[model samples]
Target: MSERKKQHFINSVMSYITLSLATIIGITLISIFISFWVTELADKDAQAINLSGSMRMQTYYIGLVLERENVEAAQQAIEKLQNTWNSPLFAQQHALLQEPKQQHNLLTRHFGIAYTNWLHHTKPILMAMAKGQHKRSEIEFLLENQVLLTDALVTQFQNDAERKIVNLRTFQLLVLLITVSVGSLVFYLLKNRIERPLSQLTETAEKIGAGDFSQRVDVGGTDELTLLANTFNRMSESIANSYSKLEERVDERTRALKQHNIVLDFLFQTARNILESPNGQFDFQTTVENLSKVLGDHKLELCLFTERGEKPYLQLVSHNKAFAHCEQTNCSECRNQDSSMQALLLSRKTGFPITIGERHFGIIDLQLNNEQELPEWQHALVQSVANQFAIALSMSEQKDKENRFVMLSERTVIARELHDSLAQALSYLQIQVTRLQKSHDKQKYELQQPIIDELREGLSSAYRQLRELLTTFRLKMDEGGLQAALENTVAQLRERSNISIQLDYKLKNVPLAASEEIHLLQIVREAGQNAIHHSKGRNVLIELIQTSDNKVQLAVEDDGIGIPQTPEKFNHYGLAIMNERSRNLGGAIEVQPRSGGGTRISFTFMPSITRQPIA
Candidate 1:
């Protein structure tokens, strides 16, 4: 609304209300002033009535004195009443008392009659009393009549006052009724005109606040209330408009948030799958197939760069099951560089780098075949997915390298043991053959029985050593810890041999490293194997105990022909393998004769580690 219109509306409302109040107050005040004036006029008339009665009494008494034949008292009384009546208080001769009437006329005429009659009645009594020959009966009669007239006048005045009082009370009641009626009318008008409109505005505003933007107040009249309603309606429209836009944006954000959540779930699942792979190997084929399902129209490829014949080779494996070209690890057939990869990444295809530290192993190539424009967020999501898998890939690569290193080191150790024990024993068999040949030639075909038994013993020992070596290589500790592996080995040994085997174990729940536990269990196995195969013992005892000094002591005892006491005679492949494993375990071994005519082989290592750090 314009300022002019608003100002005019305010002025109109204020002026109407102000005029109503002013008219009501003016009428009430005028009526009240008139009532007060009428009451004062009645009071003055009552005073006039009283003064007239006093004058008549004075006349009556004056006449009484005259009747008593005291002319002087009569004169004095008459003069005193005249003096009082004509005093300055009543000196306004022009002034006349207005006679009281039963009915209200604003102001009556012939006002001087009351004063003139009152004075004239008093003059008759005074003159009659003044005569010297005046009869007592006449004076008394006159005085009694004057008293009666005076009583009648006083009664009239009292009656007039009562009537006036009644009239005033009636007028006051009328005035009160008018005031209440006017006030009620004004309140009703104000309530309907202003309060009702303001209430509507308040209700509409509350509705809008409660998210009901469709709410609008009905506008009527060209006043400030109407302008306010119009403004409120406009505000509601604006709110509704803004809310619609905001709702659209909110919906868009919600959809985007859900999409991001889906992408995040896929990435997390991919990471979990990679970590859960066997021996920490990456299962790319299943992973990419799941990815293809999530990103349905895209072709996925896992490209790995490796060296073949000292040259860089790029291996590319596509998502299609029939599209297999090269192994993920051994990419020997691939003959490609960055240009070939760049060509492989066609116009519709994008490549996210599969990186392990500084080197980019290869790209995770994606070919988007759909017509829809790929969102930048999806591309960024693909890059993030690639980033996550790159870490898993890096870990898998490191784990495989560790496994190969472990296998190579084990092979070298086995080779060293075979050369140390079996190689030397076989060479000694070559010497035995030479000695037998020399005896046959020198003793002239008289072969020594001791030499033949020695030869047969040597062959049996060599055969046993070969079988033990094979068994050593075949032995593998399972997921069940050292105790379980030990029990399993003992059970197998008992089944393989006729000797009675016994096991006494105390090392339960020992916190040993994987390598430490594996070597320790294998050491026990090799010990048991040797006792049964080489010793010809009937019974064997294997005990794994934690010593008082916090060292793990594994002992294998046999009731059999004991090992040669000399080091040279005891040097065999099984013993050699056991010594090498003990050195690797950071422990010590002792081979000695048992107390009860048996062989006792014991290896002891610290409960945790053999030694603390050098520092």
Candidate 2:
């Protein structure tokens, strides 16, 4: 049987109970046999005592007749006594308990000896009396020891029988206790293994029936009841989830209805901020602040393109407490782009350009900080807000040109209209692919392991990046340059490993391009992973220092076993990725053994442009 069905249900429990009851009954029969045997043994001892007493009495009567010189009567009495025990008719009724009947009994032999001695003493007196030559004074000595030996034997046997009865009683008491203990233990096991879980299950069911889906039974053991409990818990979770989703839908619709009425405030707010400015021009501070309120909790970056030969003006606004010190600072590092990376390492990054009919003007970048993905509804709402911005921007830029405004309005109409025709047909192909992947070990039969692995890696990375998109809503990014990025990397590693991952910053807030920061971050992450996976490193120290040659040095040292003599011994994908990132940074990576028996991996990047910080 499968493991699930082998468990004992109610029927099996009853079967075990019945078996226990049968065992008790069998034990009871054995106990009864023992008691009966004890009783028979006591009776046998009593019978032996009685036989000895009777033989003594018969001997005394035989002696009295001999004393009266009545030899014939005496002879007849002795013969009757002998026939009662030793004759063929009485032999069937006579036996020792643990001996064979062919063996002469000591009691019978001693009794006959007493009889013969009496005859020796009495015959002399009887013959003398017949011949008128009797002497009576000497005859008393032989009678003195008469019946004494048989009386002592009877006392000894009676004492032995009493001791046997005591032992039997003790044995019976022990048997009774054993039987009671066994019964109690069996019932105890049945109650714990079956009754308690059943009771909990009953309670949980009642709670669920009362619409309390949060309640659950704590399932234990490897039995049918455990399986039942597991099923019950799953049912409860499903009900809870259904109710939760229903409530969430109700709340979402209510909020959408409320927000729908005030959604147009975003345009008025932006225009109001611009008009309120002293110079009557767009202001980043007011624009970003008002825009952030409508978009809720996400980092907002607004940039307006200036004329050629001038840098674009950038402004950032967010409600995150961690970014309080970074206000008004440049966040150019946040815009790093690595097109080759399948995963958006920065997560949910969406950018909308402020343009009117191909006339690019400004830009808006919205993102989250943590790993929580924004729901599809929220994404649509944010996109709707961005559309309003686009319209406002276009209207502001073309206040005098009605023809251009009409052209700008047609762009939105064209984009939304395409969704009805070609877009819907492409959706069908996506559905077919989804179906194909849902069969035969997720379509692994048609794909090799490496292909499957690559597919999985791409999908996993994309899903993670998408999910974490909204959580990046938190503005945890530092405007303090590479130093802040390294600190963030160290903090991430420390959270995952028990090993101490400390950062030693020797360089000031060195100015690195956005691309340089991303490359450095990837290299640091890859190096830390290599230390953990390859060398089983414990202590990892990250250091960033300016080299004597004016280049920046980033090193990760570990107190682990040194690397192999040949670096190419293993297919080190992480190492390869790290090297690629280093090359992209215009740097050289060094791998060498540490002096104290570990590995120190370092890389140096020279500044590509002749740029220096202001003194």
Tens-digit lDDT string for candidate 1 (359-423): 55556666666546566876887777778677876787789899899999888878886887688
Query: Which sections of candidate 2 miss by over 4 Å?
Result: 1-19, 87-146, 238-615
TM-score of each: 0.61, 0.33
> Candidate 2's residue-wise lDDT over 186-267, tens digit each?
7976898689988999998898899899998896766666778888899899999999999999999888877765555665
| Candidate 1 lDDT score relative to the true structure | 0.72
Off by over 4 Å in 1: 5-134, 144-156, 159-167, 170-174, 198-212, 280-286, 289-293, 300-302, 308-349, 370-373, 408-615
How big is the positional error of residue 11 in model 1, measured in Å on the Cα after superposition? 5.2
Clash counts per candidate, in order, are 0, 11
> Each model's C-alpha lDDT?
0.72, 0.62
Task: TM-score for candidate 2, please give it.
Answer: 0.33
